[model samples]
Target: MRRFRARHNASARPGRSALTSEVGWFVVIGVASTVGQALLYWVMRHWSPPVLANLASLLVVTVLNTEANRRLTFRGSPVRAVQAHLAAGGLFVLAYVITSGAVLLFRHYRPTASPAAETLVLAPAFALVTVVRFIVLRLVVFRRRNR
Candidate 1:
């Protein structure tokens, strides 16, 4: 564990690693962003298919989410933020897959899932992606020494 910390600088921020604090901040931002996405998905679910509505919500939120994590959670440069976004493209697709798959599965099984149900299903999916995002951002996107 000590060697791991030494190599990764895992505890750079006093007691806990900067990554740990950043993940706490990321959860804060993620909840807010998920709320926004849910509201948008609920609104757009009327006009679009549930999966498509989710994609639309993600489209609107991803940039904002990335930027917020970049500035607030990661404390990274704008240039590096852009690089993070580029790296995050795959993860975004992964998130979309998780979310859209959940919606699609509910609809397929229920065949008449409500908007509320769609939104409800998203809760778990978002939770899953949030962890993935944190790990990826910590190891790949904003490792402190990467600067």
Candidate 2:
């Protein structure tokens, strides 16, 4: 079994290893971003509209995500970090818009719903945005060849 494991490890492709590492890094960054966003959302809940709270959360998470992705995920050059971060931020905003629109559409269809019900409908919308962001970040912002 030990020999089999050793052979399996040795036979793994270089790109596969890097991809695995990238995924690990993504999870780490995602956790940190989630925590940051949650905290920001909690703090702003009473003071702002839900849409504004969401935007503030997005902004906070994006900054944390950019720094984490640059230093840990891609190990990108410092020179390119700012450009990559800006591009990622644009993508983040696009995702946010899409999610927000989806939530608004749902709310329009169910105008009498409770806030909890609206939040349930919005969860999948934000999830869609997250998946898109992950793909864009991996394929565009932090591609191995580009870095």
Candidate 3:
């Protein structure tokens, strides 16, 4: 009985630890990506329309974020780099729609709002998208390589 219990506990540790590690790395990468995108958006907005700026910034950061997640967060995943980017492309479109819509809505309500205000509106949208991105990346994009 004691030996069986020890084996069971030991066997369970890897899955739990892998998940915890993935979550930790995902968050670290996500926050970095978020800051990067936000800064890019700020810089781009000075010349382009808000929606276009948002699109460009997201495009840049999405590529970077997917690669980071693949290398660090989902290390050992069997999915090839191209396939991961394909999946991440879909996620990028979703994020762009959500965030750009937030910007548009903010503008509609506050037409005189500054660039900072637009970014503020995007913050919650980014937060929501981050949670969804993690779930999809884990269950769909990476889908875990066989141990």
Candidate 4:
């Protein structure tokens, strides 16, 4: 019984380590993706409307983000490439709605808020979506399959 318990714990250690590593990679990739999207949104907003810019920037970054998560953060996933990306699309939609809604709501209230202020509104929205995104990616998109 003691040997069995030790063996089980030893095996479990790698699982825990893998989860930690996955989360770390997720954070790194997510931060990079968020910054890139914010910058893109800033640049696009100069030429396009806020909602259009937000939509375009998110569309661009989401592809990269999904690919990065699939390749780096969730490297151990047995899911196929196309399937992973397709699943991530749902997350992208969720993020877009949250972030764009926040920006629009801010604009609605302030009427003449600066771009920087609008960008600041995204901070909390991103934080909220990121938490939800991580949970979905971990549980649904990147879940390890028992072989």
Candidate 5:
């Protein structure tokens, strides 16, 4: 027992839990994905209807997000991946509602807002949503209890 304790203590490093690593990766991925989503939305808006562009960007990013989180954060199995996709469906809708509402409200209040301004407003808005997404992904969808 003493030997085991020594070994465990020796291996322990402060502020470096598995969860900390996962969160670090999650933040990295979230930043990259947010930029990608915003850029995709901006470019697509020029060629497609606003609603369609939103859907396309949301769908693409959500799928990519799920896969990335499954591998990097959750380290999920095949079944867990399927479950993550299902959970992502609900998350995607919730995120869309949150982001789209922000956009709509911004437009209503400032009808002449530039596209750049809209993106600036959305960056922080989506950053807040990203926190919620991480919580749901970690606690609910990828919880070990489910598998």
Candidate 6:
């Protein structure tokens, strides 16, 4: 048993370990993005269209997240990093669309609910989308190009 365990530990590649570490870094980036979005929302509360706030927040978060994910998370080759960043940005846009559609559907179904109430429910839905985004980034976009 001890020999098996030692062998298993020794067989783990540094590349695989880095991928795991990247997920941890991505979580931190997600939290930061959430905070940035909240701050943008608070600042833009007076705007007629609140979605503008979300867009602005998404822009800010995307740049920050891309930089952090490139440097700290995946640590892919320069070519791969650039490609992954672009792909991930596109995915984020798709996530936004999905999240917005879901929120609108919720509002339509629950017409009696206040905007705040609907937003509260939609927050977690967006969070779920974010998780999907991370998985795509990790598995598809930022996946290391095996040399």
Stretches of candidate 3 exceeding 4 Å from the true structure: 145-147
RMSD of each: 4.5, 4.3, 1.2, 1.5, 3.1, 3.2
TM-score of each: 0.83, 0.72, 0.95, 0.92, 0.83, 0.74
Best candidate (score: TM-score): 3
Write candidate 2's Cα lDDT for 1-147 as tens digits: 999988887877666887788788877777666556655655665577667877877777777777777788777444387787788778778857975686568768876655455455545665556667678877877765633
Candidate 5 at residue 83, lDDT? 77
lDDT of 1 by residue, 34-135 (tens): 888888998899889887899889877777888888888878434476697888788889999999998888888988788988888886787788789888
Candidate 5 TM-score versus the reference? 0.83
Poorly placed runs, candidate 5 (over 4 Å): 1-16, 48-50, 76-79, 145-147
lDDT of each: 0.82, 0.69, 0.90, 0.86, 0.78, 0.66
Q: Taking the tens digit of each residue's C-alpha lDDT, what string does model 3 give over 1-147?
A: 999999999999999999999999999988988888888888888888999999998899889999999999999988899999999888988999999999999999999988887887886787678889999999988887576
* Candidate 2 ranges beyond 4 A from true positions: 1-12, 76-79, 109-124
Expressed as tens digits, the lDDT of each residue in 36-135 for candidate 6 is 6555544653453445655665667667777777777666545465676688778769756765576567757886765455456546655676688788
The predicted structure with the larger lDDT, 5 or 6, is 5
7-80, model 4: which lDDT tens digit per residue?
A: 99999999899989889998998888878888888888888888898989888988898888888888867888
Sort the predicted structures by TM-score, highest score first.
Answer: 3, 4, 1, 5, 6, 2
TM match of model 2 to true structure: 0.72
Arrange candidates, best lDDT first. Answer: 3, 4, 1, 5, 2, 6
Instruction: Output the number of the lDDT-best candidate.
Output: 3
Candidate 3: pairs in clash: none
Model 6, position 67, has a per-residue lDDT of: 73
Pairs that clash in candidate 2: none
Clash number for every model?
Answer: 1, 0, 0, 0, 0, 0
